[model samples]
Target chain A: MTLNRRAFIGTGAAMAAALAAPAVRASNHGKPRVIVIGGGAGGATAARYIAKDSKGEIDVTLIEPTRMYYTCFFSNLYIGGFRDLSSIGHSYGTLAQSGVNVAHDWATGVDREARTVTLAGGAVLPYDRLILSPGIDFVEDSVSGWDVSAQNKMPHAYKAGSQSELLKAQVEAMPEGGRFAMVAPPNPYRCPPGPYERISMVAHLLKEKNPTAKILLVDPKEKFSKQALFEEGWNRHYAGMIERIGPDFGGDNVSVNPDEMTVDIDGVVEKVDVCNVIPAQKAGRICEMAGITEGNWAPVIPHTMQSRVDENIHVLGDASNQGDMPKSGFSANSQAKVAAMAVRGALLGSNVFPAKFSNTCWSLIEENDGVKVGASYEATDEKIVSVSSFISQTGEDADLRKQTYEESIGWYSGIVSDMFG
Target chain B: MNWKHDRFWGVLATVAGVGLATPVVAEQQDARIGDAEAGKEVYDLCVGCHEVGPDAGNGIGPHLNGIFGRRAGSVEGFRYSKGLSREGRLGMDWTLETLDAYLENPKALVSDTRMSFDGLEDKADRDNVLAYLRQFSDSPQNIPESAPTGRAREVGLSQETLAIAGDPEFGEYLSNECTTCHRIDGTYDGIPGIVGWPEEDFVIAMHAYKRKIRPHPVMQMMAGRLSDEEIAALAAYFGDLE
Candidate 1:
């Protein structure tokens, strides 16, 4: 029905207005938006899984400071003079490919009531569901004389990267027969076996370069990760090179003198050429600010990885207090999946399935030798508890060790692919 | 007048037929229980731990060879908690009613029981497990002969089946991952070497990871990536090495 110019304009405007009305309604329709903070193992995996599985029903956004993450899992190999940092680093390009809106910014604060995450760049990203996996924060005040400035002299290579490099350099540059002291923090920390693993890697390096060098491990606890295996290996391979001090042997009590580069144990001040002070850690600052952290870690429901304090928010990875589960990359990744499912279910109004989680940590004693510990967990009440667990028995045969070493490598590739590709 | 009388007689006959059917339906409902033949199908989940054969050794829990007449904690070689042993000394035997109750709610029946199981919630499931338990006794009743086969063989292969198979190429790729908590040459604490260990032991260890019987969080996450076939291959590859 051809008509005059005024009549045609009026019809076109009416049709356009009708189309625009639905666009406005669509923005406020269907499922809720989920904003994930951090792009490490937990955060990245949650974002990818949620975005991909939501089938465009839920909006997902990931806020991370960096585009690439150098994993702390294999960072020790780099410190031990075996692998480079590039080999362990992963990028978030695959996450972007999964249709997650990756925002390159640090999450400064979260508005729990409003359900919005405030970024460092002053952007308030709104979310119906929020998942936080920002990892750990070191307790600077726990050490008597150690602060931010002292980190340069006595590096805590707990978080990997430059700190790991610094520690490696210190070990490399030490004089022959130099005393290397490692002050391990108390229990309930990230990577329960990490400090012990570091000692093994460092001892491996020392045996080749400085045979007479002394590696003194000052731990707060008497027994440590894979206690039997480490003792067997030390006595057999690094005889007289490593001395471990537990609480019974005056290792638990530590007073650091950062200015002097010295640590005192049981009133005995020992000056060292190299010192690695791993301070006590807590949930990342964001968790503390959100009031999710009870003491140093966030308490979460194991089945869903949902925050106990706020049901709308879910916490995962090293930041969470999942009892009996050590803070490791694998645990973080596993938790991310549980969190993803819960977030998806909550947003879509679907049934939340019970979550079963598994974690494995492989530590290299030397170049090819490896040992591991693993567990499976299920959520009970409000916390994750171990349903089953395994420790590699003492005196493993050569084939088992060799195969385990191989399995460890395969796991790394698989997990990195699963998390970030 | 003849047609109206015929329709009324037909309606009265239909009412009498429905009235007679109610009592027959009630009798059928009462006859469903005590069917041992039907109970065998419900007992599958229990056979993994409790075995009936003479050659069957302890598989984490005690053998059920004479469980019906035996006291709860009298089984030797199997560690029983003081609570269970004390209860055993008091002369506790497995009766049908007690067994039914215990099987229905193990933790409630015996608090702090180390069974690690939340009892069978379904009445039919509890009845079947009880029926299956009864088959192992000296007095065999009308138990079904068609119990599922291959359960014992499958239980034995649980660990072997769970290990990750080693591929040297994949192994080399995985070596970097192992360095986080394991050592190849030097040992510091309790971390073991992985260079030349037996594949069978490695496989068992990996199975432990999958089963969550191992206590480490790190290994649990790492083990989650492996498939059952991949675990076997990894185990075979590792077990074959020197």
Candidate 2:
């Protein structure tokens, strides 16, 4: 069928109002509670969108154990000492201003049948719809001898708060000519190109401080996200400072000893002054309890972001299975919009418009040079498929790189405004 | 008198049933060619190449007037590659059904056409464009003022000399091989440099094909075959020169 432009716009507006009216009526009926778990990019955006779109109709109870969220997007800059932690770490005061009830409590369990959330404090909050965006829980067993305590010596820095700070501290304190090892995760992980980007940023930092210092990357996959661009950037900017270990070069297997800050590889134990191990991940605990997560991640219908297991609950961001879309801040934000639109359709008895999602990930290769890859996606029955994709080609014009770097910052601001403002 | 009254009552009931069904039947028959007027606006992007008029020069594309019945790559003063002429022999035509399938997904229909436009995603737009094209030249009486020479003679080459590697009988065999990725009709994308391409250019391109130069992997493989003489004969056969 053809979608008439006028009809689409009218339906969108009507759906918005339809979503708003119930929450409005419910507010007068003493507020339909909305308890959002996690305060990362996905959870925060979902909470903000629900609060704003519902027009104060929703009493949004955001349950995040952390007082502030430090974005993983810009954590590389913090690691490089280009920016401070305060810059990336954001508070919920802005959410609070939008009439969200921010609670510093972890969600212990979800009573999905009763539609109530059991917080750590023994207080039960009832919700008309529970949005679970609790980000990811790293698989500790993937790497031998790696556990919570082991992270004290060798930080994962996968989540961008204390781990990030500790990783940065270790990098700063490393002696000259020391070795820094970063273990890369396999495919279908959050920020597919993030580990490589992190390596680039760290190499950039290490070049001036300790010229002899080396950054060794061990990866299971032969090819990585944006392989051409990353190799070109590494060769041009940080020549000889970076060594990549692909599966072809016997880099597939990884065994780490977190306490020793060493990784054993193919009968050789390489001790490093600093180590960053990004473990395998799965959907958060809430999704497991809600029965939405199949094994590790939630299976969602691409068109609606509705859970395949339960239609009443919709999953968004990193939790939902959006094929070919890396778990990233930009992707999470895009998924949130789709989820918001679907939520409006479910509540208003209106048709959900077929959505088109697009995302771009920018990696800083040096202080000035950056690489980007992006794609537009459409939903099918099974998964979200790429309609059009583009990458900043190797040896791109200097002006284009500068323009893209600026575009990345602008996109970041625009997306943040669209979500929280 | 009672029997006559019963007959009259039965006749009235039959008429009433027919009357009730009349609008529904008519509605089914008169289905709106689904908003062709809306489709006209969407057709703006397509008019650049497919326009029909006396002033329209066969640019990189053929004049699309009376395209439905026309033999593939038969346009005069325009050159077609071997892929198109081969396809024409396979009884391919620009039928409405074929056009609909082509417009929805071009590459899926013809893997090696060069038209860069992605398929129109909206189904209604496809229907509208199809109707619009039908309105232009469905009848031979409305055909544009263009005469068709024999398909072989149009490209300025004779078929006998061109049939060096494969016979004219083998043209069907070669054509079968071509239709795997090429379209006889002009509706396919990526296969564009197919119809109306220069004969000499085709021969040179095939013989000179190299890895990574042709952009598509299959073309590179196909081009790797055939001696230079065979390439010329195939080019001549496709140029429809006889």
User: RMSDs, each prediction?
Assistant: 19.0, 23.0
Measured on C-alpha atoms, candidate 1 has an lDDT of 0.66
TM-score, B chain alone, candidates in order: 0.43, 0.43
- Per-residue accuracy of model 2 over A235-336 as CA lDDT, tens digit each: 988889898887776677778887677888765789999999887777877888877788789987665566777655667777777554667787777677
Tell me, by lDDT, which candidate is best. Answer: 1
What tens-digit string does per-residue lDDT give for candidate 1 at A16-58? 2222221222245465688888888888878877887677777
Q: What are the runs in model 1 whose C-alpha is more than 4 Å off?
A: A1-31, B1-242
Can you list each candidate's DockQ? 0.03, 0.02
Could you give the CAPRI-style class of model 1? incorrect
Worst 10 residues of 2 chain B by lDDT: B145-154
Off by more than 4 A, model 2:
A1-31, A348-351, B1-242
